[model samples]
Target: MPELPDVEQFRTFFHAHATGRTVRSVEADPTIVRNTDPAALDRALRGRRFEDPDRHGKWLIGWTDGPALLLHFGMTGDLVWSGEDPHRHRHDRLILAFEDGNELRYRNMRKLGGVWLAHDREEVAQVIGALGPDALSIGRSEFGERLARRRGGVKAALMDQTFVAGVGNILADEILWQARLHPRRRIETLDEAERATLYTVVRRVLREAVRSYDYVGRKRSWLTHVRGIPGGTCPRCGTSLQRATAAGRTTYFCPRCQAADPAVGSGP
Candidate 1:
């Protein structure tokens, strides 16, 4: 699934190609248009000039002078730009034609995600109201406060969208591994210093992931490189990594590095 970093990349790409450009036309697969029909989507965005785009969690908001276009990339959705006569992929569910003859396509292979139309800012807020603060925008003090409030395992707290938005299974695992906290360790058990380390590591890991464009571009030293494979070893130490279910998702961590004991907190 596309997380915060992946959505940030999509937001950047959307802004670069569509900002200040008027929508000349729209073609969409009705099945992929959520909350509104295909004709309604066209009517809302047909001639509106796109302003700077914004992203909240895994959701992408295309701001315009009128209605806003909201997108959730679900598991396999992507936003791609194409030339005037660009070959259309079969999975291209949504297409927006700019006055310059260029096209922006929302391609989804699995069709799990869809698009939404918001006529007003309040409508936009209604869509994302359930989500907590954007993970990247949380300050140190706020992150510490949020972390301190959670009674569940630290990994579960991190993965909960209502606790802190944008973090998914992959990011939760990466953050815990980097912070050297066991996935099942209770948040309250963390000392002040440990909490501070977690706050710092969360922002650092997220910022680095955003700059890398996506998780696949993460460095070899990152646990992501080996976490998915069987018998994978920790990059920090040569110790064999362990795998188990945490927060209802498959999780990976170096047992030697991130022992279950709360006192054990040492990481690169």
Candidate 2:
């Protein structure tokens, strides 16, 4: 699924190409990933202009003369800009053609993501209401407040949309590793200082992700580089990395670095 960072990258691309552009026509082929009726989408978006680049959690909100388009790139969805439509990609669920003859394609290989049209602000709020504060924009105090309220494993809490939106599997793992806290570590066990550090780590990791265009593989300082390695070793401690399922997602951690139990000498 496209997390906050990947969505941030998409937001950047949308701002550069799609924002403030007048729509000439609309195309809907959500035979694979439809949220609203294709005809309804076309009716609402055609001849309208996209204004106000807004995103919350993993959802992108695009405003038009009619309804706002709400987008969620589930697993394998992305936006591509094409000067000319060569009829190239078959998985484009939504295509918006601009007055300038440029094309914006919302392509999803697996077709798991969805696009919805919001007829009013209440509708948009309903779509966004299910999500927690966006991981990137939440304040440090708010992060700590929310983290303090989680009643499950730290990883699961981080992944929960109702707890903190946009911090998905990879980001949770990376942030936990940076904070030297195990994925399974219970939130109640975290101290004010530890939680504060985690807040800093989450912001740092998320910012780094947006800065690198979701290319953590190219960064040596990122623990994501070693995540799920065939014979992965912790870059910080050189101990062989361990993996397990947390919140139903494959989680990576260093046993020597982030101990299983923090009460009994959890390593710093």
Best by TM-score: 1
TM-score of 2: 0.94
lDDT of 2 at 242: 92
**CA RMSD, predictions in order:** 2.0, 1.8
Q: Name the regions of candidate 2 deviating beyond 4 angstroms.
A: 32-35, 84-87, 266-268
Tens digits of per-residue lDDT for model 2, 105-130 = 89888767678778889999987777
Q: Rate the local accuracy (lDDT) of all candidates.
A: 0.88, 0.82
TM-score of each: 0.94, 0.94
Clashing pairs in 2: none
- Would you give me the overall lDDT of model 1? 0.88
Alpha carbon lDDT at 175, candidate 2: 93
Local accuracy of candidate 1 as per-residue lDDT tens digits, 1-268: 5889999989998999999999999999998998999898999999999999999888899999999999998889888889533888999999999999999999999978799999999999998778878899899888877777779788888988888889988888889988888898888788888899888888998898998864663588899888788888998998899998887888999888898986555544
